[model samples]
Structures are given as C-alpha cells and as structure tokens.
Target: MFKWEQLHQYGILIIVLEENNEAKWIIALGDDFYYDQNTMEPPVGDILLYEAALEDNEVIPLQYQKE
Candidate 1:
C-alpha cells in the first residue's frame, strides 16, 4: 500500500528504482515558482534525485544517499 503526499508545491518527478522487499524511491523536485508578490525566485536547491525510505508501507522523509 502506498499513500501519496504533497511534497512540493510546484512540481515533482518520481521514479521507482526497485520493487521488492527493499525498494528505492527516487524523487526530483521541480525548480518552478508561482508568480506572487511575496515570491520572487524559485526554491534554492540543487535539482537532483533523492531517496525516500519506506516503513510499514508508508513513505518517510527524503534521505540523501551517497553512492
């Protein structure tokens, strides 16, 4: 079972690396900002793939894996 959650306000890219007992979820946050008076530029962060863990069929926070 997988529960979807809103991670980013703009957009996101998801990719399932593996599907088994130990699965890997890769996510990439989009670099787009909404036009508003308070908001000027996009989010300050590198556009890269991040790994997310699963616990009891629930997705946890994003974790950066070095490999």
Candidate 2:
C-alpha cells in the first residue's frame, strides 16, 4: 500500500511487517552509486523489496536491490 513517491529519496528503503508483527529495514543504493554489499545494480523501473522499516520522516531509495 505504498506509493512510488514515498520511496523517491534517501536511496531506497523497504519495510516489511511479518506475521509476528516485527518490522525490518532494507537499505539499497542506486546503480550509479557504489555499494560494497551489492554485487550488481538494479536497472531503472525496477522495484526491489527489502526486509526493512522506515522512520517517521525518512526518504526511500529510488534504486533497486541487486539480484
């Protein structure tokens, strides 16, 4: 139930609430940006899901997660 605009900043952060009611946050950088944790970069128009949570006022990354 999230919108693209909601994740258009601060790179990309995905929040997933599990059945246990726990939230996880996944942090991702853009293809143009460099990341040691990621081997490959996500292409444009790609939506990457992550196990992460968002702060009250945080910007989501527009980049996708590698593989």
The C-alpha stretches of model 2 lying farther than 4 A from their native spots are: 1-15, 25-44, 53-67
Per-candidate Cα lDDT values, in order, are: 0.43, 0.44
Model 2 global lDDT (CA atoms, 0 to 1): 0.44
* TM-score of decoy 2: 0.22
- Give the range where candidate 1 is weakest over 10 consecutive residues by summed lDDT: 2-11
Backbone clash pairs for candidate 1 read none
Residue lDDT tens for model 1, 1-67: 3334423223334544444534455555445422345775434433444455544444334433445
**Candidate 2 weakest lDDT stretch, 10 residues:** 11-20
Superposed on all Cα atoms, the candidates' RMSDs to the truth, in angstroms, are 10.6, 10.6
The Cα error of candidate 2 at residue 30, in Å, is 9.3
